[model samples]
Target: MLRGVTHHITATREDGTVFEVSYGYGARQRRLLACLHCDWEEQITYGGTRHKGLDHLAQAHGAVGNPTMTADARARRQVLWTMAICFLISAVILWWATSRT
Candidate 1:
């Protein structure tokens, strides 16, 4: 069975403390969020997990900063960019071919 892709959101304090929250869908397609610094987790049936994670970091850990996505999320975004470029190229080629014919 293929595993679901997991992405992490990290926050840091000025004191150099770091906190991370991982959010992703499970094998059964249930959305899950878990904090790396503590025993805090939630199976989200609705709403956004990112806000929840940010809230946790700010409220529980007092770590406030612009959260950053981990490599997995960046890779996913890269895939989207690649796909959009490929689609645009194909559209242009199709338009050129039809114009010639």
Candidate 2:
């Protein structure tokens, strides 16, 4: 799952059997998909860096592992803020131009 982009990360035992973490802040749930003994697929939205949410997909129900195992949430908070700013700016400009005519 090292294809897209990396997110917030946490290291665990070297056994490679740790709980993987991925934030999936979908339009619905801010899910945290935690995979066990494996990786996950992720994507960056908005600011092209900050992530939307998290998804946790545990290996097995009550599997033995650590929460500090997940790789890392690469995106940052700035991304979201940046996106919000741009959107607000665009909205203001659109409203202003429309009201003029």
Candidate 3:
């Protein structure tokens, strides 16, 4: 419910039944999925968000056609590169200290 923190997915069945799925970072950056219609909330331990959303829609409401969505690949790559750079810098520092000793 915080602005820009959660992603919401909604699917409506032929009889106008609504199912809502929300994805967000919970405590310790763990991914979580919540349903608005019932008491069904769980941690996303594996698989993609869209797959889980669509499956929930089908099983609960018999609705379909929610496209498979994924996180931004460019952003993910950027994060990976940043981590690699930090690791390289730490390795160089350790090497220099060892060589001097």
Candidate 4:
């Protein structure tokens, strides 16, 4: 189920250190972010992947500020939000129907 290309990120620290990060629909089609440096990795189960990745970069690697969300991340977020809204509407409709009957 990975339907698109995986994003690869490179962050360089002020001390000239570099880190490699890869995130996307990874193994088992789960969204994940993994750092190639120092064993920092996370599976994005909730919230924003960009935020988590940026946090890791800033805190661990001394990266400056948060980086913009990649195109893939943005698209994924839109899809997730849309699905969530649709699910909420469905649940509401189900509740209303049940109450009416």
Candidate 5:
């Protein structure tokens, strides 16, 4: 029944991380490929190109603070980095204060 299906995707992880899973099926030899996402994960078989049902790790954990970042993702990483630095500083201060005798 998937003869008309083209490229497809079947997420392998679920964490509300990705926006969508790029999937499509083909009518040829019944092959499929998918760009996995956090909200969906499934097996697919149809006529298509290379494997795709895999995590888009680059978008999820790609480089941060690069001059190329120009969107919300960059903003999100900045906030997270700032928070991490603040937390580290706080931990060090706490250690020093408690160690003082």
Candidate 6:
């Protein structure tokens, strides 16, 4: 089983054939971009997997669209943002309370 954050991208070609790509870390913690429709795969080295995956879809499969992140990844990002905001608010409140003394 894969163990890390995974984001999926899907695109449909002119013939209505759909292709999907997965961008995420593999079990060994290496970032990867893999196509579900073919044997194409790339080990991401510089964090441009999104563009690479989209390019593959358009150039190789003649598919184009605005790729979207998976709901789970989006939810995880939202949770992290919420936690950061909460931490900031709590820090401000603590500083204000301490400075009042």
Query: What is the per-residue lDDT of model 3 for residues 1-101, given as tens digits with 9 covering 90 to 100?
Result: 21224777666578745466778877777888777776666777887776787678778778653464334433444576898899999999999999996
The ten-residue window of minimal lDDT in model 1 covers 1-10
lDDT of candidate 6 over 40-71, digit per residue (tens) = 88888996777898889898888874646456
Minimum summed lDDT over a 10-residue window in model 2 is located at 48-57
User: By the TM-score metric, which is better: model 4 or model 6?
Assistant: 6
Better of 4 and 5 by TM-score: 4
Backbone clashes, candidate 2: 27
- Those runs of model 1 whose alpha carbons end farther than 4 Å from true positions after fitting are 1-5, 67-101
lDDT tens digits, residue span 1-101, model 4: 22333775655567744455677776778788887676886888987766677778878888643366355445555676898899999999999999996
**What is the Cα-based lDDT of residue 3 in candidate 2?**
25
Clashing pairs in 6: none
Superposing every Cα of model 2 onto the true structure, what RMSD results? 15.3
Positional deviation of 5 in candidate 1, in angstroms? 5.0
Worst 10 residues of 6 by lDDT: 67-76
Question: Number of the top candidate by TM-score?
Answer: 6
- TM-scores of all candidate predictions against the true structure: 0.56, 0.30, 0.54, 0.51, 0.35, 0.57
Model 5 residue 55 CA deviation in Å:
8.9
Ranked by TM-score, the better of candidates 1 and 6 is 6
Q: In lDDT terms, how accurate is model 1? A: 0.73
How many Å off is the CA of 52 in candidate 2? 19
Candidate 2's C-alpha runs over 4 A off are 1-75
Give candidate 4's TM-score.
0.51
What's the lDDT for candidate 5?
0.43
